[model samples]
Target: MWPLPVRPERSYSGEIRNFSKLFGTERNRFGSLHKLTLYYLPIAIFVAVYVLIILRNLRWFRIPVWTIMMAGAVAMIFSGAIPLGDAYASINLNVIFFLLGMFSVVAGMDLSGLLEYLTLKLLRVAKSPQKAFGLVLIGISMMSAFLVNDTLALMATPIMLSVAKQLRIRPGVFLITLALGVTIGSTMTAIGNPQNLLIALSTGIPNPMLDFLYYLAPPTLAGLGVTYLILRWYYRKEFANSTLAQLQVNPREAIKDRKLAKLSGWAAGIVVLGFFLVGIAELFGIQGNFNLGTISLLGATIVFLGSGRRREILRSVDWGIILFFISLFIVMQAFWESNALQSLMIYLPVLNRSDPGLSLVTIILASAFFSQLLSNVPFVAVYIKAMQAAGFTGADVKAWMALAGASTLAGGISLLGAASNVIVLEEAESRGSGFGFVEFSKIGLLVTIPNLLILYLFLRVL
Candidate 1:
């Protein structure tokens, strides 16, 4: 079957007749809605797998998320919901390789003991329990602005569990603060997280790093303050009258292989520089199309070659999550091809020349629950595409900025809101301390709603 639908050439009158069914217009093109019903079977299969996967913890069957998503992708292809060529086209290789490269680099950092070193250093600086919690929060926030927060969360959570035991601090506060800070600081920079990276790469964002810092940093910083207060308020007894338990840990002991560390660190530097120089250099008469994925892959190659145990570090690249993202890209494209997102254009006011404040508010409100419903990354992809169809182009600087701000901020709205939160929860559980979905949401609401409201007001005045 052809990957793209073949539509009959119709006059204005005929098109007007089909206007109400635009998103599902395939029915009209096929001559009957019944003929197109089976094409949507993949959606049902995908939804069933999705629901069951989320319930895996209830039973002893521990199926990975990647498994379910890939099953959906395969089912869609087999059922002709998405053609083979369309499925291939739907996967964004850039995002996949970008994630793999970053994961490889962080895996090297793990080999060099950098994660342990940084985690220990952050813990040693606190003089008391309150100071410790605050210090940890700042460290996580700062680290997330540049490094991948998921990597940080995976490595840091175990160390934090150790801190919880020694310092007698509540594991809930320490873990939750880490989750909050990771989400908040990620909004400060495009490179901090995946959603930001996607927005930065998509057209309409100018000077990604500079633009984010200037516009998003203010509210994100403010939100961090709110996160701190709410956490302290909720965990007041946990933070009060705490003794400084000198860490029995020494970071130096972990660095038997400094050679891999230095190589990984150098590779990270090169990749970061490459990201900044990619398109900016073109403005200065340098002619080349540089991509973050290729450059980061180069960094990964460097680490792989230098590290003697390439197989071991390569094995740790979170391949499951990467595959999950790839399958997700394809499944999401089905919705896009069906014009499901384009239909949202009508609800959104014209973003090209609309009031900046109103546009910001609309994007924020829509992205908040939208993200929770389908996850932030998918929502951003659909939202950005929808707005572009609605006349919000790269020239609409405010629109894209609003998207980056609202999408990233809204990722903290619930437990399913962001990958980092889920990572922390899963990782914490492995270490014998983790909260349920209800507790996470209860804590999240205490800070998220108020912070989002303040940001809405702040944007209105700006």
Candidate 2:
């Protein structure tokens, strides 16, 4: 039989050392797992959402974007990737409220028939196919600078189609023009689209409205002009030997509620005027900490309560979109806390350089290309975080403005590149024939490339 081993003395110090070893092993294991879950899980969820968005056929089943965002957020919470409070705090309420207001006001205007009346009047003046094309460009571009491009696309697509039908021309080019117009024009103002709103709120510029007007507006106008010419040339065959013909639309008949239409118009005017006043007020330090979202929501609430179409308008409001924003915040915040993005940026040190002009161009290019792949709204959300992680400063508003322009304008490069463009395409389909993806990309890229080139030059020079 083997001799029995001698037992060690039962000392407290030895027991303590054993305990420390056990504790350290458990801690290291836990930490490693935590880091993995924090980064990979959210990235997986983010990618899944992006995939669903890219594949248009999946939308036929009516899977709302909110569903995907919620799933990602819930996964993060359950995985312990982020604390509940931090995740909740990640959402920018100001941006959410702003989008809500835009939705309600747009719904109110459309329901009040004010949108139809104005659109018909614009259509009536387009005497020919070429004139109709030019007129559509002008109207849509201007409207998108103030009105969210998606709302204008929904309202204007049918109006433009009516003009095209009257002129005996293909509706495809006209509809595409509207999609491209809104995509380009939305770059003109902070309130122009959700992405712009997100960028403005994130940067906290003292006078975001003025900044947009001064730095970005000129470029936006140039882009629209160039886009107009490109579209005109591309559709030249369609307008060959055509003369300006009077539009068949009757503005009077299109106005269903005379008083309501007038009221909605005034409400829109007041909201726009309020934007400037509030922006200027903040600029002069009267209400330096003022939130433009509040002003916009105030306008929305007034129009909602006064328009007498509460049921219809409220029901039409994009609540899903609001939810999507909230969930996206939670998911992105987890990613931000993960530190993976910061680690990745070590590979691109030049992007984090301190030159405002060069940095702005870099951001614009990154945002524009990824926007075509990921869609501008979500891309902006994630990209802004990435920028912050890269040590980007908001000291210069030019970079943010450049991103706003590049991202919004990049939507014109592909049919699937933007939410507003998708809305226009679907609406056009419901009305009549639509352009296929191949045809759309051909013209879309042709126009968008030159505009981006012009914008890059404008930013570099001025």
Candidate 3:
């Protein structure tokens, strides 16, 4: 166990108790109120913030999700749920820098139109709606495994919309397909999404990329196939009579700047190669201090130096998401320190440390349910701490992998379950075409059940 930091006498709780001694007659009442405020306030703030996030698109009270989380963080600080220094320490700079680097590289790719060129090339082979649907499902899923789901969602939204229009079919189905594809595909790699990254970095997984592939790749691929069949069956009417239009477009012509595209492509390739090399080396029992963040940052440096559009790429990085992560760390840390989460955990199913099978089901079920309430990233952040506290160590590979898979698949449970889902929705809304909450949840529920079952079965047997 890690040693606890030494606390001085004048700590927050000490002050509360000291103050209560002065008002001896009413001390009991006063102390009770203070104790309640200290312990439960953070939980209340967390729930309120998430509620506001769910209702963020309400017409009369529009607010950004980041702002809500930031507010909760500030409230936690001022309320003394956590010390200011601890709050700062809680933010994971590795995750932040990794995201920053990736967003920049992706921005470079999008700006150069290389991503679009490649996407079109992949989609152009479809001569009918069913072929296009399968391609979008499989193609986007494969890309998301390496590129990150949220990034792919942002880049693929408009393209899916365009494809829907060309084929004279509703964009809603394609957009839903895009959302499901990314969610399922991202399950295969540590760097595929933020939650998976959190599990990889926090759990001390020796070869996160390879471990994820060995355990999750099979289920992820199976989930994609299952998702494709489900969507085809569900939207049978839409796919039954549709044929692709002769898209008079050339994929090569989509590239705006050949020089930048080449540079960006090289940068992306090097980053992916670095990830695999590091993982392979670890697998062979060679120890080195390589991490996903450093490799990604290296890729970003290459793009910044080779491409002249550094400023544009920097601007394109999702600053709001960066801010959200920062604030989320603070808030979640405060929540954990408050001891409320620990108290609440007693009421939940106990993870059987001796029995991997029962523990797997417990972890997956809890992760899927809570992820819908707290979202996958934040849920994973706190759950990692919980698992460690429960005596789960780095050597517990199966347990950690289960957490990663179940938490990620949880995103397909509802519209608010994943940040990528929100990104796709916001992008589609900006284009004046979007899916409804109910519409998304309906499809999400159908897709998540079988995908989760596949994940469980694969993890158990493999």
Highest TM-score: which candidate? 2
For each candidate, the alpha-carbon lDDT, in order, equals 0.74, 0.78, 0.86
Residue range with the least summed lDDT across 10 consecutive positions in model 2? 344-353
lDDT by residue for model 3 over 1-462, one digit each (tens)?
999987866658776877767677487787777777678887898778767876776688788878998999999989888899999999988788788888888888888998888878877787777887898789889988888789889988998888888777788998988998899999999989989988887788778889989999999998999999999989999877677764544789889989889988999999999999989888788866666888889899999998888898899888888898899889888888877777756756687778999989999999999888778987787788778778888888889999999999999989889989989998999999998899899989999999999999998998
Error of 1 at 249 (Å): 5.2
Can you tell me which runs of candidate 2 are displaced by over 4 Å?
1-20, 55-64, 241-246, 288-290, 344-350
Models, CA RMSD each: 9.9, 3.8, 9.7
Q: Rank the candidates by TM-score, best first.
A: 2, 3, 1
Scored against the true structure, residue 108 in model 1 reaches a CA lDDT of: 88
What tens digits encode model 1's per-residue C-alpha lDDT throughout 1-462? 768987887679766767756856765776554335343465465556557555544458666667877877777777667777989987777777788898899888887887767767776767777777787887888878877777777777876787777777767767877787888788777778888877877754656756667667777788888788788788888767567765565767766569987888888889888877865664465645457677778889999988897987888888887888778777766655654454456654455446677677778788787777766775676677777667677766656767777777777778878778888988998878887788888888787787777667665655
State which candidate, 1 or 2, has the greater lDDT: 2
